[model samples]
Target: MLFSETELQRVSVVIKGILTPYVAEKIDKNHYRVRTEIKRPGKYLADVFDSDNLIGKINLHVLSETQKKSGGDDFDSMF
Candidate 1:
């Protein structure tokens, strides 16, 4: 999920050394939903762009199947 004060023009994720563009669905004026399949476990970066300007960068962490079953990290819940 991504949100911005301005409309987002595009969203792309860097996966496995490749820049992949994902479909961004606009829920309204400032909200967007991006769905993409990631098969590997690693860290990724999602770039958000509005027109020609870079608006935000999002960090995505993917866990392996085993790690997910083992309850990978609870630190995020602390917030």
Candidate 2:
């Protein structure tokens, strides 16, 4: 999820030091949703931009299948 005072124009992710752009959809006046398929497990950063300026950076952690099973299904509680 990405939010800004203005509309968001682009979304991208930094995986293993590579910046890859992803498709973004406007959900409302100031909110946007970015979806991407990450096959590898590791740490990543989601970058949000509005026109010419970068507005946000989100930290994302992807766990492997084994880790997910061991961690249980209550994902929200792990945070």
Candidate 3:
């Protein structure tokens, strides 16, 4: 999937909004990827400032329709 400049910007905004409060720091970003350091809240960051904390990582991927539908390892051998 190809995203236009505007579309990518939109995606970035959405991702940033969701991630800013948890990330230790925002490393960098591009159209296809973003890298950052983050740790869990409260216990991990008692008194630290961070853009986003690390509860988990999120990856935005564009998958083909067929791949999305037949997606699984349970039938890998059968396939």
Best by lDDT: 1
Candidate 3, residue 59: how far the Cα is off, in Å: 3.6
lDDT of 2: 0.67
Local distance difference test, per candidate? 0.68, 0.67, 0.33
Best by TM-score: 1
Provide the TM-score for each candidate, comma-separated. 0.55, 0.54, 0.22
Candidate 3: tens digits of C-alpha lDDT, residues 2-64:
122322222322243344532222223423333324332221212122123222234444345
Error of 3 at 73 (Å): 6.6
Instruction: Kindly list the per-residue Cα lDDT of model 1 for residues 1-79, writing each as its tens digit.
Output: 6777876566443334556666677888888876668788888876666555666688778778878866855775566
Error in Å for residue 73 of model 2: 6.6
- Model 1 stretches astray by more than 4 angstroms: 9-16, 63-79
Q: Rank the candidates by TM-score, best first.
A: 1, 2, 3
Winner of 2 and 3 under lDDT: 2
